[model samples]
Target chain A: MMVMTQENLTSKERFDKIFEVEFLPQIDALYTFAYHLTYNEDDANDLVQETYLKAYRFIEKYIEGTNAKAWLFKILKNAFINQYRKKSKAPTKVDYEEIINFHDEENDTNYSTHTDLREEMFQSMMGDEVTNAINALPVDFRVVILLCDIEGFTYEEISKIIDVPIGTVRSRLHRARNMLKGQLKTYAESLGFKDKRSKD
Target chain B: DYQELVRKVTMYLDNELSEAEAYLKVLSQEKSFREFIKSKLHRRKPSPALIKSIKDKIKT
Candidate 1:
């Protein structure tokens, strides 16, 4: 077995420390990401299980002071993609050039949807509405939003986790938020929140 | 200008910018924008049994 050169623990102790500290605490976060990707509890649990298995086997490569969360997230994302590829019998379709080339507001056809709405408008937005809106987004856009908004990862960190450029992370987030804004507005309006712009 | 505002807001949200940045100052005053940024999405937790299963695998 390979050793972590910088860490003080021996191999057995290192495995225990990695699990107790770095890996176990992140199971919730990893499961959340996996759930959003698969939208199935069993598949998500399987993905998380596989991720920890792989992380355990390769624990020697994990630098001690580095971002353990980001490393695990990268592994989870890759596992999700691999499973997706195998099930689909095709490569995961990513149009990186399109994501890279698209302008943030080019297709923001709902620009004035809820931009002027107040905080009270969203107070009535139940978690189910928010969850459904996020789940409805395309996976690329959804992943960035989950990482940045829900999980609160930095753009640079998300870019590394998802294997995209920082610019792409920004573009995807902008688009995702815009999409969510429109969807959430529909739910809010349904729940009796007025679009202030509709008043104007 | 909207794109620039988004960039600034994103940078601010991620703590990449100083709190004193002018755009962030304006953003801080916008309660609605703050609500939007709050992203009240539901996050699911893994089952305890699954966690136990993984831990068992790791220990073996």
Candidate 2:
């Protein structure tokens, strides 16, 4: 819990109120979302710190009694898209099949007991395959999938968040799910599941 | 025809399609479509560490 310095605050009373009310409960969740997007602990911390600083600077613009989580995510997502994604091209163009195949090959020798292997497979997943699959999708589909499936946002909320029609949200979600199913099918086959058919 | 069927079955699985539409789809569709949707609905959860990492990032 980092405290806001009085010198950094414009007014002592106002800073006290903001610190007491807005800053405490929301910081953890905000940081977690940032971390997930950045995929780096240090970067996530910096993003959260930056987000709070920006939010604090423009606190007057934020409407009270509205959904704070949505607002925060919007800011974070925008920051990620505009600032981070643009600056870094390293993570943007990953080849999913190659990565998965490489990883599978490297870990092949470690397979021992059935129970241990299952547990290891589960532990190794780390959502990398799913994230890679989603990232490989078109931007519209990726955004809709992340908001709806990964973040558990509703269609109406996503409509507001992405500034798209509800119908568009539904259509994109459908496409995204289909794409994910296709990717998962490949992953399953690689893992020796035998079945390569779409389940949905 | 297969693509159209797939799209309809997808909507039905998501419960987005109307009852009448779903009824038509399910009745006319191949058995494999239903099996597909059933398996898809049972998606595995992402690893706990991944969830925790995301949660931790948001918290920071």
Candidate 3:
């Protein structure tokens, strides 16, 4: 892949080069993120298309050969908040940040005794159990878990992508994992899998 | 202390922490922790048609 200087590249060439090289490769990831956000195939496709169109319109703002995935993700996330959430009339998110600040004990006391998610159970488990559990979470927590645990974005990158502080990302991730564990535990018990926390 | 350990373990798995980060060393030695890190949720892939649509949208 040839790296083109922004100055030398014409408008068409720059859009083509960046769109093909930097943006298109991220299509699947952007789609997946969009799907998780919208929970509908058509809506996800629209969100991704809007993101790409928006990315092209603002192409000069993008630095070539940089973190294009994060850049695209930020655009998609903002589009979801600004457009989809409003269009759907989604309920306003209560400020988890305020609760997270004053309610520190809830974080430690509730989760301290919990064991890590057992791999053996999840191994035997099949289908959309994991995906369903993730989807069941609130959008804020869901995004962190997807970005960190599933997509493997760094905390710094996730913070920037979601436009939140890194500490908020960490706290949301921690809380999200705990919530996911509770949900999965219920699911495993329903499937006759034993809780091995006491044994471990 | 337990909450701190969980934080470290999550950070360690996410590669946000250094290898020699304290407490993570012991947790990393556990089999459950190792396998848990490898477990992932299923991700939806964009349909081929969707992919083509984006490419066409960008080209024109």
Candidate 4:
């Protein structure tokens, strides 16, 4: 059997190993998330670098074999809020519209009898505008939508990440989706969405 | 009723629905909204330079 020389690995070597194995893989995801949060390539790069720096600094506290991605994400998110958010001009929040008003505007819930193929056609139309709509949101609302809709995190996972109660996550998600629907309403209508049910 | 439908839209997209038919119905009712959210499902990774930069910056 080969000798297991544990002491041969220096602290920097060990740190490099963990960083390469654990942290490096999450760079793209962290950058993508950073991009969505900051809405600027340069800011995203800065945010991601800051996150990696922090993660490296506190690498000793990180537990191996756990969810490294989530841990990195938590650090990135905190870094985004603590660093990027404070420098941005948008106020942290707006008044919560107790009722989601988008659906209330045109509730002609008369289901369109469009074929699956036609539905697919409409789905194909929903590309770039969705990205624009997502980016247009205030940072706080945008984060929830990105975490839930884009990243596919569950409400509980998001609650844990954002350090909010699950109920808050739910409400925030609800509001964010409503806001997106409102922003995309015009674009959606132009694609033969509104009043198409009347024809069908 | 539309708010109820909106909730269904969120649940359906979230894969929380038990029945596929129910999800399709939710999609059918909130057609535009469903399509919009589904479109956000695609992936986007960072550039190679960003990855290299992270690697470079992490060194002591």
Best by DockQ: 1
All DockQ scores: 0.42, 0.13, 0.39, 0.31
10 residues in a row with least lDDT, candidate 3 chain A: A112-121
Proportion of native contacts kept per candidate: 0.60, 0.02, 0.56, 0.49
The clash count of every prediction, one per candidate, is: 0, 17, 0, 0
Tally clashes: model 4: 0
Could you give the candidate ranking by lDDT, starting with the highest?
Answer: 3, 1, 4, 2
Candidate 3 structure quality by residue, lDDT tens digits, A1-200:
86756765677686689889889899888887888776678889999999999999899899999999999999998998788567668776777886786477556764444323334444554355766777789989988877876577899999999999999999998898778777777666676655454212
A49-166: candidate 2 lDDT, tens digit per residue: 6665566566666666577667776776676677655666655677799799767766777545655876776676555565556547876676665555445667778788777788
Model 3 misplaced stretches (Cα beyond 4 Å) = A1-9, A88-127, A189-194, A198-200, B19-40
| lDDT assessment of candidate 3 | 0.76
Q: Which one wins by TM-score: 1 or 2?
A: 1
TM-score of each: 0.71, 0.54, 0.72, 0.70
Worst 10 residues of 4 chain A by lDDT: A191-200
lDDT of 1 by residue, A79-177 (tens): 987887787896667777767645554567653464435344545543467667777898789888778766889888999999999888878877887
Q: Highest lDDT among the candidates is held by which one?
A: 3
- Give the higher-lDDT candidate: 2 or 3: 3
Query: Tens-digit lDDT track for model 4 on A1-200?
Result: 85646664576688778888988888877887888786667788888888888889998888876778888888889988887546676676644552445345335454344345557865665556877788778777888888876677877778888899977887788888778878877877787666232211
Off by over 4 Å in 2: A1-24, A88-128, A138-140, A189-200, B1-60
Show model 1 residue runs off by greater than 4 Å. Answer: A1-9, A90-127, A192-200, B1-3, B18-40
